[model samples]
Target: MPDTSLPKTAADGDAGQGGGPVPRSTALVLLLLVILLWGVNWPVMKEVVGHMPPLTFAASRLLLGALSLLAFAAATRQLRVPHRGDLPLLLSVGFMQMTVFTLLVTVAVQHVPAGRAGILAYTTPLWVVPLALVFLGERVGWLKALGLLVGLAGVLVLFNPSAFDWAAPPVLLGNGLLMLAALIWAVNIVHVRAHRWIGTPLTLAPWQMGMAALLATAVALALEDVSRIDWSGHLVVLLVYNGPIATAFCFWAMVTVNRALPAITTSLAMLGVPVVGLVVSALWLGEPLTLTNLAGLGLIGAGLAAVALADTRRA
Candidate 1:
């Protein structure tokens, strides 16, 4: 469930200070924390999925988050069942945002390094910017258009033939899957922005998360070998971290930041997730930090910042 204490908008200074717009500093801080949690989640997921099947690991994490949020909603008396009209939207969002996105990412990590996966996933903003313009009727300035081009150039840089032996089908397939996952995420974000679901975050979040858990669990049962799980100590720790901190807490924090910040700004803030993931993976996982990787990161960051700053000025 969303934090009840948090303000739904910055108009009333629900986050403190005067009853004005939320401070940029405060919004940035919250968004940065969200990035950090999500950034670390990649490597954590990679480690855990090493011991468990991808679908099963995703199922466990979602189930745990669902139970935790459900308990919180029940205890706080904040649970509200979705209306008939809202049910399909909520279920579709859950499937796209939670089940398909996580499952594809987990499977991709098995073939690609966590850092690479992080870099690929952050391309979501590139996709979202164009989608937003087309679907949401958001205007894209010349600067943002240039930024989108540069971001695509960065993707091409990362797609060098020498980066991975394309002869290896798994690696090629994994990269494609990661790209598909980003598209799914782009769609989910646009859907959320388009819909007018009438409920507080506390009431809505749990239902979406619970539905995702149930759906993921069902899929896992039908497809994955649950008996093959190693159930090691490291795996347990990673699952706990991914569920409670990364998924549950970060989801709420992201919603809070989104309410306070512009859509482009929020998406730009997520660029940090890949940066942190790359650095952390290099240090902890011994992943190589090559010149091409750094160059790609620089392009991505610059393009994202360009788009974000342009949006902020427009706002």
Candidate 2:
């Protein structure tokens, strides 16, 4: 899923830059598709790793997704190497957000339930509040502060001693890794906010994806047993979904929606991702949803809505 901390330029509407603004109806449809693809992908990735090593599966999908994005960029005549000045932001996003964050989520999903993993991973915006205060010198308005506290309360609820198994090493490791992934993504979002636009995020995405692909591949080769990969039809189907649909199409759709819709609308709507993930995981994987999970999800949605509204008001 795309970050909640949208760049200033994108938030302010860059629709006129490349092409005319998309129709609101069209943009909403695209946004819904993005939500479905990304939300369902949590369970998809969870299943993928069950059949192969996490890093290797991550590496393969990254490579294919990078290529697919490149093709999209080229077909649209938007393909170009990033400007020299964009390298710093590019490297930061590529390594921290795309590679490391993805690796952590992929690995952690092996031990964590996909529903809960989705909630934890998408907490990137909550982390962004603190990171932005430090890195961007942004003030914490009361609305945002309240939102942060509420969101964090939801996080604590998810980890409540009565509901969570704190004694399980695998559970602890998975939850910890997901939190780290959220923080890493938050850092990328702050950098995105601070970056001067040498290229629109869409224009630069393929390059960043390429870098991530290369780095993930190197790591996977060094650490993972590639031979363990099951070359089955199911694996192929899953990879196709991850590469072209989830990664490539969803990113493109999100950018389109960002340009067409108001920032607050986009951010608020994106919260549906974890909700969808939760429902899909329960139905598809037979993962039981507890009362604690429902309560936490409600609080998280409220918190995220408050934050999105606050951001729009601040803007």
Which candidate ranks first by TM-score, i.e. highest?
Answer: 1
Q: Write the per-residue lDDT of candidate 2 for residues 1-315, one digit (tens) a residue.
A: 122443455334333443344676787799889888889999999999989999998888888888998988899988987777668867987788778988999999999989888878876656665665566555656776676677667766765657678899999999999989877766665565555555666777898879999999999999998899878999899999998888767765765565555433454455567778987998899987788878877876787677767755755
Whole-model Cα lDDT of every candidate shown, in order:
0.71, 0.75
lDDT of 1 by residue, 1-315 (tens): 111112244123223211233466776777778788888888787888779889988888888887777788789987768666456556655778777888888889999889888878877776777776666555556776666777666655755557577798999888899989888877766655554444544556678788788888898999998888997777778888989778876765665455455444455557678878887888888888888878877887787777676755664
RMSD of each: 5.9, 4.7
Q: In each prediction, how many residue pairs overlap at the backbone (N, C-alpha, C within less than 3 A)?
A: 0, 0
Pairing residues by index, what is the TM-score of model 1?
0.84
| Per-prediction TM-score | 0.84, 0.81
Off by over 4 Å in 2: 1-34, 137-147, 251-271, 305-315
Q: For residue 302, give model 1's deviation from the true position in Å.
A: 2.4
